[model samples]
Target: MRNRLVFSAFSAAAVLAVVWPFLFGGQLAWRDMLVLDYPQMTASNFGGGDLFARNAPQDGFLSIIAVVMPATWVVKALMVASAVGAATGAWWLSNKELLPTLSAIALAVANPFVIERLLQGHWSVVIAAWLLPLIAAAALNGRALLVWLLVFVASLTPTGALVGITVALVCMNKHRLVTLGLGVLYLLPWAIPGIIATFRGGQDMNPLAAAQAFAPRAEEAVGTLGALLGLGGIWNADAVPDSRHLGFALFGLGVFACVLLGIRSVPKRLIVLALVGMGIAIFAWLAPAAMAWALEHIPGAGLFRDSQKLLILALPAYVAAI
Candidate 1:
């Protein structure tokens, strides 16, 4: 009962965090929160367009459901359900350490970019973001069932879910392979659909074409060092020119802080989580080309476009850090 009450309080806080700004900014909506191009894809998909968000419209799983459901109230109901699930996941994964969990979620919430994502109806990001900690918890405990469940839901969003699940696994100790298997399992269902979507949408990243195009840009200052030092380059919400670019400076700082915290305070087992997270982080930061190479070579890998999504690798690192 105490736990339930505490969970309720924190959930309330999370919802308030998300809603307060909209209210303050005078953008509160009685119908929905599709603030920008969000409603475009939602509206279009409802009208039977599979060409939804070809240029990446925040990966609209929640919105897609809103379109599919018959009842008007179901959309709002599901939105609340997703938000509650995310909050519950956050609470369960916090290790009874309220401050850090609240801080982390709060940081994510207070972030102008994140707020903008909410306003723009990027419910998928918010939904995936809320699930990061729970996924980490599942990974740490070697909860195969939980891990796969997350992976399956995650694959639907492809990019963010992969990012979150990858980060969570990197933070685990006992079930790295198990988590990988789960990720693969979850992604398998979407393989055909994603491939079809890519071709139909013409958004597939042509590695050969990208490499050829790369000849002139001189890499455009995308080094991991520059990214890390720049606070994961998050200050520029438009930093990577797309939502797929998860390399925000705030995320970097969060991971860095996690590393320092692990070194100072966390247990050995938990430190293992941090170490794995840092390993993936360093790999992404240090040898980005190699990272890209691996992603390209790996099946279902092309679904993730930006190297910055590697920031999802830092979620567990934050868990260990805090």
Candidate 2:
């Protein structure tokens, strides 16, 4: 009962964190939500359009829901659900005593990566991020089939798919070949479109220039560094709320102290995840030259135009590791 209460509190907090900013006017006038997609989605032949033809299947699925329900309600529900789901998933994955689980849940659901994504109105990525912990839990339990299905759902977004693959690779220690095969099979729907798009070659930008453009700013480097410790980092100045820098600093300090006190208890994989996430972020932000070289020479490195998306994977890993 106590555990349940703790989980409930964390879930409520998570939902509120995401929804609080929009509660004032109860408006659904945000970025993609206010676009023509809402009307297009409400139409019976929503998915038949070219806009959705190349889009992730998840978009179509959401459109179907919108067709029957109020669009505003659907969008609001999903936003809240994403936060609660993330908190719940993190709580389950922690598998620790109350204090650690609570800490992990707080860090996981309230971080900068999530806040930034929410602000950007990337619902698919948000949903995928929320599902990651559940998928990881399934993988750790050797529920190979369940993990594959969850990964398939997550793969509807490219970033989510990448994180799914990482989690599967990390957790599916047994029957590795079978897990790999399942992953390939489930990812085909999303992968096929991306593959075709890549070959079709749209507007090509200088890889280094793209990286430098999207990389975290130097002034916000502290937040990005704090993100390595499970705080938030939002690169866009307009998107950041007041006092966020101070919040990031406090969160980072708290996490640092926790790590120092519980270093031995931390999972090795989490340390590895932090290093990998930080390395990718730093390379894109500070070493754009090398990233550009990779983009120029490597066939698919350009997929990571916004290399900061790698932090999505790191956030969940940070929670589970805690």
My TM-score estimates for the predictions, one after another, are: 0.57, 0.79
Q: 25-69 in candidate 1: lDDT tens per residue?
A: 222243224333123344333222474232232234435543554
What C-alpha lDDT do the candidate models reach, one value each? 0.48, 0.63
**For candidate 1, which ten residues in a row score worst on lDDT?**
211-220
Q: Which sections of candidate 2 miss by over 4 Å?
A: 20-29, 32-78, 175-178, 219-231, 246-248
Model 1, C-alpha of 103: deviation from truth (Å) = 3.0
The whole-model C-alpha lDDT of candidate 1 against the native structure comes to: 0.48
Residue 300 C-alpha lDDT in model 1: 53
lDDT of 1 at 66: 37
Across 1-322, the per-residue lDDT of candidate 2 in tens digits comes to 8888877876787668666764443445455334222444532232232222234555555566666764456555555665666787677677658888888787667666666666766666776777776677677778888777777767756577777877777876676687677767655655665555556664556776776776664323354555544445445555554555545445565675675566555456655765686678766776878888887777557656567767666665667766
Candidate 2 lDDT (Cα, 0 to 1): 0.63
lDDT of 2 at 78: 56
In model 2, the worst 10-residue window by lDDT is 44-53
Candidate with top lDDT is 2
